[model samples]
Target chain A: MADQKEEVKLLGIWASPFSRRIEMALKLKGIPYDYVEEILEHKSPLLLALNPIHKKVPVLVHNGKTVVESQVILEYIDETWKHNPILPQDPYERSKARFFAKLVDEQIIGVGFGAMAKADEKGREVLAEQTRELLMYLEKELVGKDFFGGKSVGFLDLVAGSMIPFCLERGWEGLGLEVVTEEKFPEYMRWVKNLEKVEFVKDCIPPREKHVEHMNYMVERIRSS
Target chain B: MADQKEEVKLLGIWASPFSRRIEMALKLKGIPYDYVEEILEHKSPLLLALNPIHKKVPVLVHNGKTVVESQVILEYIDETWKHNPILPQDPYERSKARFFAKLVDEQIIGVGFGAMAKADEKGREVLAEQTRELLMYLEKELVGKDFFGGKSVGFLDLVAGSMIPFCLERGWEGLGLEVVTEEKFPEYMRWVKNLEKVEFVKDCIPPREKHVEHMNYMVERIRSS
Candidate 1:
């Protein structure tokens, strides 16, 4: 149901997990919106104007006002529309979902990207530690649940699982880390499969080889310089 | 209104900025909640049980169920009890507010703490850069507005303003940073003063000396080791 009162537009970067989260949320809500793919390296002046502070993307522009940040966009979407609620009805359940979602934002998204972006031995070490910690926490938390939010794919699942294939392709799996081993994180692995199967997610994800090559190049550049 | 059906208990540490956001939200909502002071360093089993992954405060336990993360807790409170709503009525405004709030959480909270926690010169440099970026954004965005949400304090105000006095007291001002100078961030400074005057906020905030001492110790520890 596209409302005539306001036009919905999304300013995003293709490979950004943050952008991916907003895209999935919008799609799941069945909200039709225009998408503007921003070249993050050479950011658009419009993107800068919309998000001057962070200058990062997945910005959702509705009726001219721009909303930056993925989780916030998710909340805005949930509140704006009633259909296909991403958050849980139960307050506590909603909080837990949001907490884990924040965890993914802080730990996984932050460190995972940091690891790929930095090539220095010290930075890599820090990234490795952070990554290991995040995976360990994920392994423990996702033990029984099919997704982080339980049976149905909810906010936590969408936010946390969005980064999985990207992280795997970025050599997170090849980092000699045991955080997501089959024996330890069986449910997490299953959740990864489930996330990969989602149509919108499948369609939206960038090629793994490109991401890997970019990450490797970045890492090498950091290490050498 | 303390309804038996909606029993609310807040598990929090006295000095945590994150926990203070929830406390402010609950107070602003006029919702009477049972306050449980949690020792974060030696987390109680109950805290672990409530939030196994993060094992942190403030955890809002409602009717035997728990909600963690301050931002999520604010949303839950707003949803559960619609009185004095923390978010905006307009969808676009709500999204903008939430986006800025998330920015405060991600950039300010993360990088601010990093500055205080790290001892190395390089770490401090990184922290300085991030802090400057966040503050500069805040300064520009907050121009002419009494609060981020405008007119009256809202979710963004509570979340963003919570850090000000703490940061100021913990050597942010002493560091002679250009980002949050009085000339640059007049609105932010005014907002900080207003927040400090609030009874609930005044009661909840830790003493300046304690914060300064703790931060100094952390910095020294990081440097020495």
Candidate 2:
């Protein structure tokens, strides 16, 4: 256990919200870990070996054992560390938090990427509709609460908040869609602003232009094709 | 707590894999609760009141408090109960399990439903391709393991396996596609067979004819539209 504490390392990409999820979780838990930024385009042998199935970022290596996937990593961090608990101790609340987190990951993240990569008007419309539906759900469910779980930041906030700036930079701003406007989604806007103040999150997020350029390139590719 | 446990009840639709995910988790945890099957086509007033946003099936009520979403309900059940734990204690393993489970839920389930709801060549091809990808990842990651977490049927297995019969019925037989052939996905097939044999699962899962009929109707509607 003593040796385990000293060997925590995170393999991630600079601009990835998924990677930031693990990063924020570790920071929130006050665990010290070595951060390794992987060049996702180049594909590192170590990254491939660590996450053969997905070969994606945000792989946590502890005592030589590796765990991939950001949502999974958040849970692992909460379970591994007892202090500064990110997940609620009560089962029902924990479930609600996780389910909301999964909703963000599955519906919001999935549809956001789909919208970014889509070229056709119909495809874009489908993605937009899905995104709107998600936003509406969030607006209704998360109203009057500072975080999804209320008061202090918890797992859902960490996962959902980490993606906001990136999604705004990439999906919403890049596509010129007013999916999450201040007028329509005041609560989400408040939540996003609150998340930006967190120290680790401020430090770990990628430069806004990088995400914009990347998304612009994708949109251009879709248009040309 | 005892009074709270007594008031717990599950509002579910029998054919839904999502509902089954909750049922299986509760059964595994040895929790005693009343189960009410909701008719989804004409959603009961109770169901609508419990889950106004999605108005979806598999809503769990504990002491008159409702928790919607099957994955959310599963986590709630696991946390509420002490015996027969479904999720791993270690953070890393839990994350890996969750990531895979989410992948299954979002990708596999999404594609599976798509396959069922369309009769066109493009739809079938997309479904086949996605199913193959999901099975490939599962086979590679879950090789030699009895369940996703090695020996016991944890959260991953419950979430992933909940959809097997639906896939086999709609994906394999109804679509006339060999999505999980014996040679291509031997391990997945074996796992599905093993999961089906569980006593609670066997009792809870609806007969194949019902799912096939619903899927065929969906396909007709999609094609006509």
Candidate 3:
């Protein structure tokens, strides 16, 4: 990374947890980056050239090398900027962190968001049951831990924590489908509060009112369509 | 890894690409591991305990430390073993490998498999087109490469190559849907042949006749139910 003239740029969209993951990682690492807000409907030529495969936002270009995929980007950032140490040093612990983060990403984006987007009433019930089970699993994983990284905000905190605000906005408030409550998942709730207090993440995330407004619009569009 | 006494064990099921991935990686690294085949219908308690979240196979237990998820396991193996060096040394190159491997994993398992599993005649046509497009995208990525890893059979090759034989046996020969033929994807077809030639992979994969029989059974079961 030192050999080349260093220039870090992150192309991302607001209200996208995936994009926000990269944004938060950059902030956590104390890495200064140029944030390019791309319109999802009309992607920039630079994004198309950099990430021809996905053509999506949250493309990190460091020293002119492009890295797509949020989790992959997070890994790249952690590897490049070794100051914060979001991922664990031990191979076993790192693997576990990756596993849980993958679970949360796939569950929220693939199953929960997907079912919420296109499901009918019966489908919503099934989605609700599945979401509850997923949250419970995460709840168990977070027991006796202040963060997924344990006493510090780490990789899972950056990845999973980025999605929590959206869940709060869309699932809890907008759609009234509560998955994480203090009663059920006290640990996960605490993790969310811990993430919110982190100076880097606080700056990276949008305010609650803005998130609710955006998520409400998304919910309406997805439901109507 | 050398300093400590190593006890590597892998829990996997035969006729599964994900399982085969770990098998191939262990072999490529020349790591001796006890392979325990678990019946999917009745998952072993050890399997459940090791990977409580997914409860799936291809779990690698190294010195009593458990690692689940095939890609994460591959990374852990590379990190721990460090002899074969499956993942690239450069941060950018490593990120790219993770990105493409993830794309192939998600696309094949998520889109192609899902559509192929549940689609009708008309639906099959659309799914076939989608599959072809996905393959074309991959083919484009493999323009001048001998393998996805370029010089040697690396991470993407191991993860992706494991899934191709099943595609041939299940999707093409068994079901008459050929998304990857020599005419269309010579590089990919060549990759399939090349992966078959690797000593570890050759020893690990099920025989052609056996694969055909198993895939036929899967096709029947999936189609029926």
DockQ of each two-chain model: 0.68, 0.61, 0.88
What TM-score does each of the candidates earn?
Answer: 0.81, 0.83, 0.92
Best by lDDT: 3
Backbone clashes in candidate 1 total: 0
Which candidate number would show the highest TM-score if scored against the true structure? 3
Question: Which tens-of-lDDT digit does each residue in A26-57 have in candidate 3?
Answer: 87777778899998678889889988777887
Residue pairs of candidate 1 with colliding backbone atoms: none
TM-score of 2: 0.83
Candidate chain B TM-scores, in order: 0.86, 0.90, 0.91
> For each candidate, what is the lDDT?
0.73, 0.75, 0.78
Worst 10 residues of 3 chain A by lDDT: A165-174
Chain A: TM-score in each model: 0.85, 0.89, 0.90
lDDT of 1 by residue, B22-76 (tens): 8888888778889989884699998999887678898998787778778888888
Candidates in descending TM-score order: 3, 2, 1
State each model's C-alpha RMSD to the native.
4.2, 3.9, 2.6
Per-residue lDDT tens digits of candidate 2, residues B1-225? 234437878888876788888888877766778998888579999888888767998888887767887777777777676577788876666777777887787677777667656667787877777778877888877688877867777888888877765534563566676567789888877777777777775666667777777656656776687
Instruction: Return the candidate ranking by DockQ, descending.
Output: 3, 1, 2
Runs in model 2 deviating more than 4 A are A1-5, A110-133, A136-146, A149-151, A169-186, A209-214, A221-225, B1-5, B111-133, B136-146, B149-152, B181-186, B209-211, B218-225
The deviation in Å at residue A70 for candidate 2 is 1.6
Best by DockQ: 3
